[model samples]
Target: MNTFAHIKPIAQYNKVSYYSVCIEGNEISLFEEFITHHTSTNKKKLNHVLDWIKLIGNKYGAQSHLFRPEGETADASALPPKGIERKPHYTEYGKKKANNIRLYCLRANENVVFLFNGDIKTAHYAQDCPNVRKHFKLANKLTKAIDSAFANKDIVWNDDCTEIDCEDDFKLQF
Candidate 1:
């Protein structure tokens, strides 16, 4: 009861972040930052991206719990240990196509998170550097949104346990 009361707002906020990301590389540090909250905000576009993040993160509880990145793309953090499926999707970049690109989710703490891509088709063209950034950024938002929603509901987010899965993770499992 206490947990759901605490996290209800987080879910509302995360629902927004999930929609905030449309362009590539705009939302990466979001999901990861929620848990570690250590992203550096080093990118020139930090203001808009960070604003979106904080607005959503605040719904959970506090921002300090999240892992802040020194730079948006400084390093690639593997998805959280809570097992979820990675569904391969395609994106196109210039002349390159990133194939079987996984559009998937991660359970970061209590967050109900996942990634998105523009590669609805012709994935081979999705290999451009821009595509990578876009993917990472969108992935960030999905992650943050997930984090915000699940706030104190980690068990619910993970079906590998008895708690019934919530929102989208139950469907995302591959």
Candidate 2:
């Protein structure tokens, strides 16, 4: 079955531009849905992931070292790798120990990234985790489709390669 989706920019910073996928007929993007779903059950992990996203977008510039490869067939990755610990100084929340939340994405380049959906990984591997299995599969599929789009010139890079240039109505099928 063919699934249709579109890319929309959710956030833009001086260093990187973050885009998210919105499936056909869906009001919220996959990334947004991930945030909403985890807000109640995984607030700390969610905040940690969000903080990294902001840092990557505003300061770090989507560095490859910040993401963990998750794609089986494409160049997709997941954020907040396992065993990463950070102390959240912004809130009264204590140190961020081990975060199981995995937000899959495509690190298009130093300046571009595509944020996708994810869930709390209950098992050691995403394939073995019931919570993240579907999301992992969907993210890989979309990543492959987006990769093809780039190869076919459907998605082009800006002159400086700091951003992507695509039609507003451009739709991707996966």
Instruction: Identify the runs in model 1 with alpha carbons over 4 angstroms from their true place.
Output: 1-115, 118-128, 152-164, 167-174
lDDT of 2 by residue, 1-174 (tens): 888999988899989999999999996999999999999988977998898888888887988888877645545789875444442332334543567789999899999999999998898778889999999988888989999999999999999888888888999999
Clashes of each: 34, 0
**What would the per-residue lDDT of candidate 1 be over residues 71-159, giving only the tens digit for each residue?**
34432122211112211112234332223222223334333333233221223232344434465454544555445545655425334
Q: So what's the TM-score on candidate 1?
A: 0.27
lDDT score, candidate 1, position 139: 50
Instruction: Supply candidate 2's per-residue lDDT for 56.
Output: 82
Tell me each candidate's TM-score: 0.27, 0.90
Q: What C-alpha lDDT values do all the predictions have?
A: 0.32, 0.85
